[model samples]
Target: MTAMASVISKITAKNQVTVPKQVRQALGLKEHDQLRWIAKDDGSIEVKKANNNDFWGVVMEQQRRYGSINTPEPAWGPDVGGEVID
Candidate 1:
């Protein structure tokens, strides 16, 4: 695997870390974006950008899984707030 450049960040007293500018730029991060943290068996950790109910992302995933062209209904369940499209 190719080596990626690393940046250092200090954890705040409240256990928060400011994602460095370079990392944020490379990851295309934005304010209010969520991150998913993964822990590997080798005792190392990884951070990945988490999707925030991205519409196109859900569409593509459904197409790949169901092989259907139709937009998949959101599984927001029976009592959710979104309106019915039809």
Candidate 2:
């Protein structure tokens, strides 16, 4: 993980790609671990380990900074129509 590494994994007919063992070890990933895929403008993909606590922390930070409205649960409100395109 310290040094740069590259790995390849084939997409199955079901569109599922098995995480390469080396990459899994580098990411400290285990079975059932959630992953987040980010598509960059440069046509490359970034994979990250998804942690619920990290996600909630981000929402809490956003609420703290932007000030949440009075509701049973904090809501960010209406979507402004930003959409992702391939």
lDDT of each: 0.83, 0.83
lDDT of 2 at 16: 96
- What's the number of clashes in each of the models? 0, 0
Off by over 4 Å in 1: 1-4, 54-86
Candidate 2 at residue 33, lDDT? Answer: 91
| lDDT for position 74 in model 1 | 78
Global CA lDDT computed for model 2:
0.83
CA lDDT for candidate 1: 0.83
- Model 2 over residues 42-62: C-alpha lDDT tens digits? 999988887757878678867
Best by TM-score: 2
Models 1 onward score TM values of: 0.56, 0.58
